[model samples]
Target: MTAPLPPLVRLPLLALLIDAALVVLFVLIGRASHNEGLLGTLVTLWPFLAGLVGGWLMIRAWRAPFSIAWTGLAVWAATVVLGLLLRVASGQGVQLSFMIVTTIVLGVFLLGWRGVVLLVGRARVRRAALLATAKRMSTAG
Candidate 1:
């Protein structure tokens, strides 16, 4: 059997996959809302993907794959800003309202999962600590 991947490699790969999936979902939803067919949506996917890649590079996202402050917020902001800039540059219409909507939606999509993960991680740590304390008390008693 092949050896398992180290956390260093696996975590970054997982983070990249999750972030890319969120970006694609954001694009698909936006296009669907406007009744843009699948083919049309596919046509517009590149700009967002470009922004996502730009964000990943700017943040060096792999360094702290699970950090909301360092990774989530930075990535979300970069994705929206860079995506819109690219959209404008590519002759795609980007109205003020569209910008606002995209920002809010992508913010939720990208950061929501990170927030959940943070909460769960905290809970796990707390639980483990409590268990450790209980075990020590039981043993001492």
Candidate 2:
């Protein structure tokens, strides 16, 4: 198996890699032009966390390949609504378009990555089952 890539590099590698990529991407974009403040930072981070939660629910649900993607979009919408409520309570009308776009971007990135990991795991299991069955049949024959 060519040394098996160590324990840390085998399982959970995709999620870790995707998270690092998202962090770098968001930090760069948010900090660009030196105009991003605490609220801007929060806006970027909020949907990423939402995506993680949605992806987790997807894994639990385990119904379809697109489940995670749909869940992520739903979570992004909920975050926008929550942000709007906050803006209203604070006496500032919500910024709809910007929040929607940014949250969707973050949500899709995180959720998509997690979905890929789950799919890969499922595929591996299926392949193993098939191989086991084939081996048993061959030996019996």
The numbered model that scores best in lDDT is 1
Clashing pairs in 1: none
TM values, all candidates: 0.91, 0.48
lDDT against the true structure, each candidate:
0.88, 0.56
Q: Which ranges in model 1 have alpha carbons more than 4 Å from their true place?
A: 1-4
* Candidate 1 backbone clash number: 0
Q: Indicate the residue-level lDDT of 89 in model 2.
A: 64
Across residues 44-137, which tens digit of lDDT does each residue of candidate 2 receive?
5554445444443545322332345554455444444554455466565346665665566666664766687779989999999999999999
The best candidate in terms of TM-score? 1
Candidate 1, run of 10 with poorest lDDT: 36-45
Give lDDT tens digits, candidate 1, residues 1-141: 999999899998898889889889888877877886877787677888889889999989989977888898999998999999988998999999989988998899889888898999999999999999999999999
